[model samples]
Target: MTDAAIAPRRPWAYAIFLVVFGAAGWWAAFQLTLDKFLVLEKGKNAVLNCNISPFVQCGTNLQSWQGSAFGFPNPILGLGGFAAVIAVGVTLLAGARLARWYWWLFNLGVAGALVFTIWLIVQSAFVLGTLCPWCGLVYLVMFPLFWVVTLRNAATGEFGSRLTRIGGILLPYAAPIAIVCLIAVGLIFQLRLDVLHHLAA
Candidate 1:
């Protein structure tokens, strides 16, 4: 297909991305909130009986403060953030003309979420030494949501021509991949001692 055809069709792709992201975000939000409620209702006993697998147990991870993250519960953030994303997706789908500044703000929010999700993954894998299946669902949903939003921004010319010109076509994929790698490496190193200690114990 010609570039012209591809360019016009790009918005459809972005729309599809947005819908998928919105759905995933909503699902993650639901799971997180449900898990939190379950924790509250059954307390530690609830988690113990939640033996989905050896590796996937909400109870094991709940023993750590990292599970709560916010002193109360981390799912509350997921519930709020994902709800916002859903609203944005609905707006975009309805052909709303979001300002460039608004898109930039959305980009920043997604970036923050992606970073925090990475931290949570690292905390679960190395520090917590146990995984919450619902938390993993959130991480999985977040990875693509981050990519989709950023891709949509670039394709829709939301980042402004100046920044796009500065980085060119490669920036869209290259920058995010670089950031993900940096976070991955940092997490690996950050949890190294903790992992070792857990192993020794």
Candidate 2:
């Protein structure tokens, strides 16, 4: 990337989000990792404080194959990923300008995280039939994290010149789209988990 294309003025909003939610995601992942270790050492029968309910619990998730698809607990990835985000966010806020290639690489990482996160979401909903509260927090933070990264990258013509124009259109709609996504998550949780029935049970 040409030095001429160095990152523009940091979007203070996303910069702030990257700091705040990056920390939140890191904390949630750390908690989940600790809880997973406890489960592993003591076994599934171990009572865990994070086990809030049959539907809202981390134990069920930690014990599942989906939680360790790579032969390790997934939060290990979160530990590194969130830390990188925090570091980058601090740099941006400190008036550092990154090259276009850096933004491309950053978006690639965000895309990968988005894919894995969506898979986790599916497993939690359709397969495990349960939810990890900490995982939920990660997802909550990740949603905007991914969107902002995409929009910023697109704005900078990271994908291509065409997407640069498209990004401008998308920027205005981000808020409404996020609201719709939140409602969709709620509706899906209600439908898939029969949340009301679980509460009554």
Most accurate candidate by TM-score: 2
Off by over 4 Å in 2: 1-10, 196-201
lDDT of 1: 0.66
Each model's total of backbone clashes: 0, 0
Which residue pairs clash in candidate 1? none
Q: What lDDT does the true structure give each of the candidates? A: 0.66, 0.84
C-alpha lDDT of residue 116 in model 1: 85
lDDT of 2 by residue, 1-201 (tens): 986587566668777878997899999989999998899899978788778789978899999999998999999999999999998889889878788889888888978997898889889999998867889888787777888788867876878898999898897776677667656775777799876677567
